[model samples]
Target: MAEKIDRQEVQHVANLAKLSFDDQALSKITPQLEEIIGLFTDLQKVDTDGVEPMYSPTTEVNVMREDKGIRSNQREALLKNAPDTQDGLIKVPAIIDESEDGDK
Candidate 1:
């Protein structure tokens, strides 16, 4: 037998998600939700006694090399291109107002 989703259950979920649905919309969605639950129930009957679980469907492997300190020596060049710089680092305007309501 397929599981059923009641109107009360749908209303409770909508309340948890801060959603508001009319009676008409609720009536229309209940059967669709029931169909989805029925599909999942059908899936539970599949035979997979010897099947191995896989994280992804594809057989691709990670062939990328490990990252190294390849850009550590480019700090001088990067700082030179900056619009504004402090002692040796880039500088920008304060984004937040620290004086507002003692927020810091």
Candidate 2:
């Protein structure tokens, strides 16, 4: 026999999850949710015994190759793509005001 869960319990869970339902919607869904939970409770009765836990069913290994640094010797080619460059570095707009110009 499966353990029975209350309809109100489902509503309480929904409330905790910040979900709102009309009285009609609640009435229709509560029994269905209870039935699903009841099915899960029924499944819990089945014994696994010596079943091994699997990360995935497939025995496939990672086909992707390791990251090989194949960087180009073309520094000028890379810097040419930048919108703004200063002192051989990519220049970006200030995220925060550290100090006003001529204040320091």
Candidate 3:
């Protein structure tokens, strides 16, 4: 068996992920993480000699819509509902800086 997860290991992982936690939060989180690791350790001991692995718990399938070509005069009506529009398209907030050269 692998070595158990300790408080220092958790703190190291938190530091690597750029997470800052005070002592009280770290104390609370350490045990919860330890319990999770314990659960996984228990799971590793379960017998599965003849069992088929279950990939998904539910039998539900995606109900995909049919891809169809549409011809419409609804462009004007649709743009009416938008909070902002530009060049006949809905204008959403940009996630990145746009260049003056219009390279975006």
Candidate 4:
């Protein structure tokens, strides 16, 4: 069945979406929008009794490995590749904000 839609309702939607369509555009869109709504209404009429609701289309499986602490290379070995380091720590320039106290 074709769903009937009011022109005012479409105009209200257009206003919300910040769209300004002339009379010709409104006339063209109304029937197309009605057809899409009708198709969705028809889809709701299908029987899905006893069928499990699907949260995901694919079958669920865990690919995660067990959490365990493992020994890694020392801090010196990791820092050796850094372009610049100071006092055994990675150094970055301090970012000063002029408006730091304005909001409070």
Q: Give the alpha carbon lDDT tens digit for every residue of 1-104 in model 2.
A: 67555667767888899997778988888788878877788767779889887779888887988889997888888999999999998999997667775586
Q: Encode model 4's per-residue lDDT on 1-103: one tens digit a residue.
A: 5567767778988999999778999899988888788788886677889988888888879698889888885889888888789999887666766578686
TM-scores, in order shown? 0.43, 0.42, 0.43, 0.42
**Candidate 3, TM-score vs. the true structure?**
0.43
Model 1 per-residue lDDT tens digits across residues 1-104:
66678988889888999998899999998788877887889867888789998779988887988776575788889999999999999999887766785764
State, as a TM-score between 0 and 1, how close model 2 is to the true structure.
0.42
Scored against the true structure, residue 24 in model 3 reaches a CA lDDT of 94
Q: Which ten residues in a row have the lowest lDDT in candidate 2?
A: 1-10
Clashes of 4: 0
As for candidate 2, its clashing pairs are: none
Q: List the residue pairs that clash in candidate 1.
A: none
Better candidate number, 2 or 3, judged by TM-score: 3
After superposing candidate 1 on the true structure, give the runs of residues whose Cα lies further than 4 Å from its correct spot.
48-104
Which lDDT values do the candidates have, in the order given? 0.85, 0.81, 0.85, 0.81
